[model samples]
Target: MTASVILAPLVPVVVLWVLAGLAVAFVALALWRGLAGWWLRGLTACALLAALANPSLQEEERAPLSDIVLLVVDESSSQRLGDRAAQTAEAVAAIEAKVAGMENTELRVVRFGDGPEDAGSLAMTALAEALSEEPRARVAGAILISDGQVHDMGLVPALPAPLHLLMTGREADWDRRLVVKNAPAFAILGEEVTLTLRIEDQGAAPGAEEADLTITVDGGAPQTYRVPVGQDLDLPVVLPHGGMNVLQFATPAVEGELTERNNAAVVQMNGVRDRLRVLLVSGEPHAGERVWRNLLKSDASVDLVHFTILRPPEKQDGIPVTELSLIAFPTRELFVEKIEEFDLIIFDRYRMRGILPMSYLENVANYVSNGGTVLVAAGPEFGAVDSLWRSPLAEVLPVEPTARVIERAFVPELTDLGRRHPVTEGLEALAPEGGWGRWFRQVEVSPRAGQVVMQGADGRPLLVLDRVGEGRVAVLASDHAWLWGRGFEGGGPQLELLRRLAHWMLKEPELEEEALTATARGQALTITRRTVAEGPPGDVTVTGPDGAEVVLPMPEAGPGKFETVWQAPVVGLYRLEQGDLVRVVAVGPSAPREFEATIATGEVMAEAVAATNGGVLRVEEGAPDIRLVREGRPAAGRGWIGITPRGAYVTEDVSVAPVLPAWAWLLLAAALAVAAWLLEGRRGGRRVSGTA
Candidate 1:
């Protein structure tokens, strides 16, 4: 209960003061005139003046409100480390019990977990918001139960009372983590790029002086290298053939209080070709010579080296050999020595020639078998007696041309299998008006162990693609692709088709027969499997960094592509496998930052708590009993926690009664004057008689 006074004046004080002054003046005048019984007149005047002024007393009632205590609990990822989780559970129970026993007090418990973006702990932010929703007068104090790792300290509210912290975790905790300082999103294929990385130690590291850093590419054998702690190193790595190159860099596990899941980092670099080296060998200079040169030279990234055999070995000019304009073709230098240097070998309208000996042809076949690409652009000469089928290169070529030439205008059409293949799919642009430019000539071909992608008129094979050992080969039976480029009978996407065929034969990973691919956007990963078979979709098994397996149901996305989406729970390397395909990718941070010392030190919140006259009390030491303490007194007892009461009040107005009315005061004064006169007259008469 509480009490206070309020006032409303029924009579003005200024008017009463004037009336009293007049009464005093009249009494003084009587005394100056030596009037009989002057003391009696003054007494009568003073009694009249006292009746005008008004005064009163007011009383109020109040009941004390309950004090509010804010309880902030931390539930971030860091709190799950070691015995910290257990410690947090025990402390929460003690706090609940202690707050329950206090009188005229209420508790507001708030729990904060990891932020949505995994920014950091959100304990302070949640507490601030909770505080704003409560009454300030009732908040006696605030208590935080966390590991002292707060990411949103700027959101700490202006507390009305003291704030206390009960930190989690113990001393002597340590961790070691891998750190990637620099990485690029893309790298040129077959080029060495340098990546900067380092290993960092925090809290307490192992006793070993140095640690071994191992690096692996595409899950190959890891190469171990010794690296010093806390120092960055530039690692020169050569990217493999094509597509997304997954590189895993890790350091050996160190004995520590932290988990090893953060001890490794995964980086992906998209491989790109800066320039394609293509070798074009021609048996003789013909009308179709410009077609091959123009197509290869049109692309900025294609490095073309063309050699034409203008003069035959049997031809003997009458003039001296020096007089002839033709120079001897460097068959040995191009075909035998540096054949592997070129990515693709194009034989445009080339027949078996004596210029390239049988030995050189054998070397070309060996090159194709060892992961080199070859494209044979056949002409009428493909049906001649000197066809390449009689040479050593016949084993890798996809088609064997019969000694027959079909001369007729025919439109090219995609085969049944080619309709779904990536190389030939979505090729309506090649025949926008329902048909491509007609070819006047095409050689009859019989495909061996290869796929016939295109057929000419009369259902004869015109284009064939095949896998030759570790490499790829393509054969275009018609030499009239140039006629399309010349815009004969309505031109089509002749260049686009040719470009896709060349790129596919070079073994672009996206065009592979069987592939497993995973793409990450935010925290969700999309896994895809592409194959050339018809069956039930396979199951994609994903292994997270913590060795937890999640089987995702793959559904057919298209004719040959199967896809599934998986939401990643944590940020680290994720391994995916379906059938023979395997892929690994990193999510979130490349490596965990070593910002938290992990030792659970009070240094972060000790100063702030002390400013409010609060002391640190570990719940493990036992719950301190709650006690009500008087204001301006010490807030702690031997085995109790003290809370100070805050007294608050609101004001109200009350009416006051006047002491007396003007008419009443006037009547009393008249009566008093008459009595004083009578008394004086009697006294005077009595005195006169005595004197006589």
Candidate 2:
């Protein structure tokens, strides 16, 4: 119980002050005048003012509140290095023992590891939250057990008491990290892009002024380079293809460095092509010839070279070749000299007419075997004696044309493989039921180890696609496909079909029929499997950031897409593989923030700790002795950390009563006034008697 005097004034405090001032002035005036009843008047005024002031005795029933200390443990990736983990355990044990033994003290333990987004060493954030949940008056102190590499120092809370840091790493610890200072998110293919990188030494790196770094692209073979440390290195890289390119740069691990995780950095750059060069060879000027020309020329990124064989060399005309407005085709330059310059070559109803020599055709075949792409759009002439099937290019063709042409209106349909193929998977959706236009002709053909993506004229292979050596070949056996371009029977997806077909042949990563792709968003992996099959594919094999592998079954997402979202238990690189496909995805930071500053120091928390009049001591130097200190005093010594005693209390109940009642004060004042009057009269009468 605590007792204190409190005022309960009948009027405002200002009124009381006014009355008291008046009484003081009257007393002073009476004293100056030497009045006989001055003492009696002063006593009556004091009594009246006391009754108006209403002073009371306030007694409070109090219970002592226990002081709370927050103990935070850091388990970020950096904490896993060297003896830091063990050192942290020891510190935690000692703190718990000391706090537990203290009288009327409670330990509120809060452990924060790597955050979901890989935000490193969130000691301050966790401390702020813990402080908010408890009463500020009761929070005696906070003790953080970490490496002191805090990423969110801005969250350092307004501590009501001292905030001490028990740092985890030794002063001699050191680390070396590779930093990609600048890199473009998108790089054009066939153009060299410059990437700025730096090799940095944190704490105590070895005395080597230069370091050797191994750089690899797309998990390919590594190339080593000796580079100067402590400075930026500009690396020029040219993309091999148009797709997501993974570039991994790593430095050799030192004997006593903190960790190699930061020694390596992964950067993903998307590769895009500047232009697509296409060569279109038309046998004759036909209605469908404009379709091929329009498709390739319409794209701003494509460079189109087109030629039409107006007349064969054996044919004679009345006018001279120059006067007849006929230009000789440049077969030698296109086929023999700069054949590899074009990304793709298209042949539209080109029958072997002795125009291109057998040697040129052989060169074309050789080109396909050496990473070239070819597309054959055949008409009825493909089944004739002079068909390209008899040329040297026949060896690279996916199908051999039979000497039969089916002439009947038939709707183009996707084969079982086509329905699952990336090119035609959802083509049917664009054309409603019976919405697709019909083709009037198709050249029958027999496939030789080629995928039939489309069929026409009684289920014969209308479209065949295959890989020849290191290159690709695609064939469309029907020439009436352009009939749909004319809106024949309410036009089909004529442009869409040809566009996807060309892109797929060009080996676009997105158009790969069978592929595995994984995308990461905040440590979660969205794995997608794209294949040309009806039912579900097999379970996808996932290689985690660690080399451990696990198989996950894929679920059907769309017509030919299979996907699953997986939350990774940790942050790192994940490799996903299914069949012949593989993909690498990075979760969170490529170099986790914890490992960024591995050589632990108390520098990060020093300011905050000092702000609360606390200490920043390393655990390696031995746990500091805990002591109690007064508020506003320095709570840290060379070998000791202090906690302030809050002396907080909770009021169980309160009672108040007036020290002196109004009636009592009034009665005492009346008696004093009567006595004063009699005393003054007696003194004056005595004087009168004496004078008489």
Candidate 3:
């Protein structure tokens, strides 16, 4: 219970003040005039003023509230390293016991893990939010239990009491992190691009001069190199394939390192072609000749070189070679000399005309065998005596001509393998309601090797893809594909089909017949396996960042595609493998921000602790004793941490009453005035008698 004086004036406060001042002036004037009853007059004035100024007593009933202590525990990924988890558990248990024993105090524990999207340990943010939820006046202090590698220090709240840190980890804690300073999102294929990287050693490191670094591209065999540590490494790399390429660089973990999570890094770069050089050789003027030209010319990245054989060596026309408008075909230059410079060579209805020597044709076949690409668009001439299939180029062709041409119109369709193959996987879905447009002509051919993806009249091979040595070869059995481009019977996906075929032959990673790919949305991994083989593509083996393997069955999602989503238990790089196909995908960040700096230190929370007159204590040295201290005093000592008592309470009941009633106050004022008048009158009578 508490009591205090409160005024309830009978008149307005201004009016009361004026009456008190007049009474005091009259008393002073009587004293100056040597009145016989000056003391009595002063007493009367005091009584009257006290009566008008009514005073009341106020009493309050309060309930004592316990002081609140905030305990913010960091359980981020970095905390999982070097026995920090055990240390944190021990410190929290000790602190809880101390706070329980302290008089009039309570502890509120807040445990937080890694932030979303690799934002790292948001210890300060968690502390600020917890502070906002409780009353500031009741707060005694805040204590943080972490490795001190806080990533959100800027969010530290304005604490009303002292802030202390019970840090985890040892003084000799060390870590090695791989930092990618510079990496391009897009890089030209076959050209060297420089990537800047650095391997930093933090904390009490052994000061090794160099380390062994292993680099892997597209999950292939790794190449190890000895490189110096603590310096920027400019690694020049040439992309091996077109499309997305995943590069992994890692340094083997050392014995005494805090963790190996930051020892590796992954970079994804889209491999692009500077220019697709294509050589188009046309046997004669044909309706589909311009189809290939138009398609290649439409792309801004393609460099097309087209030529037509207007007069063959067999034609006995009396036209002079110089007088003819046709330029001589550079057979030797295209097929032998600079053949490797071209990315793709297309022979549109080309026939053997004794123009290209047998050696030149052999050179073209050798070109295909040595990592080159060739596409053949066949017509009736493919079945003739001078068909290109009869020349040395036949060695690389995937089909054999049967000297037959089907003149009947037929609708092209995807075969079972074609439906599964990347080149023609979804072409069937693009067909119009009435089916694809019909083709009036198709050369009869039997596939000797390679996968037959498309079929036409009489179930004959319409499209075939094969690999010759290190190169790729594709055969399109009809020249009427242009009909689809011309919107014949509402046109099919002519541009799409040809584009897929061309890119597939050019060795695009995404269009590979047998491939495994993985994408990450947060920690959920979406694994997709693509294959042209019959039946279901088998399950995938996923290896997590911790080297734990889990075999997940990939159910068939579509024709030739198998996919499944797996929730990852943690954030880091993950490796996926199916048969010989292997892929690496980073779930959140290759090196999570938490592990980027693992050394436990007080620098991050130094300012907050100092401002609150608190100290940073290490769990390694044992948890400190808890004590109560006054505000604006040192709240931390050598072996103990103190909390400032807020002396906060809730008022449950209040009572207010006037010291005297208004009628009693009025009667008392009148009585004091009458006494003063009587004393003055008696004194005046005595003076008169003395004078007489």
**Model 1 lDDT, residue 399, Cα:** 82
Q: If scored against the real structure, what TM-score would every candidate get?
A: 0.71, 0.81, 0.84
Can you write out model 3's per-residue Cα lDDT over 179-227, one digit (the tens) per residue? 9999999899889999999998999999999999999886679999999
* Candidate 2 lDDT, 557-607, residue by residue in tens: 987799999888767667778877777776777788777778888877788
Q: After superposition, which runs of candidate 2 have C-alpha atoms over 4 Å from their true positions?
A: 9-53, 225-231, 279-300, 303-339, 347-369, 379-396, 400-407, 433-435, 443-449, 479-492, 513-590, 668-692
Top model by TM-score, which number? Answer: 3
What CA RMSD would candidate 1 show?
9.5
lDDT at 355 for candidate 3? 79
What is candidate 3's local distance difference test score? 0.89
lDDT of 2: 0.87
lDDT of 1 by residue, 1-692 (tens): 33343333345877677877887787787667666657678767765655544333455454557788888888777778887778888877877877787666788889887787556777668888888888888778777887787766666677667777677765566777777778898899878999998777776555455679989887778899888887788888788867888899988777654767567888899899888899998877876778778888998999999988876777777778878777778778888778889999999888875777888888888998999999998988998988887889897887887888999988888877666566776676557574677888999988887877688989889888899889898999988888877888886678878888888987888887678888887688888887766574579889987799999888988766788888898777788888778888777765543233444656677666666655566645556666666654555545555666666434454443444555766677777788779977876622332343
> Over all chains combined, what TM-score does candidate 3 have?
0.84
RMSD list, candidates in order: 9.5, 5.2, 5.1
lDDT of each: 0.77, 0.87, 0.89
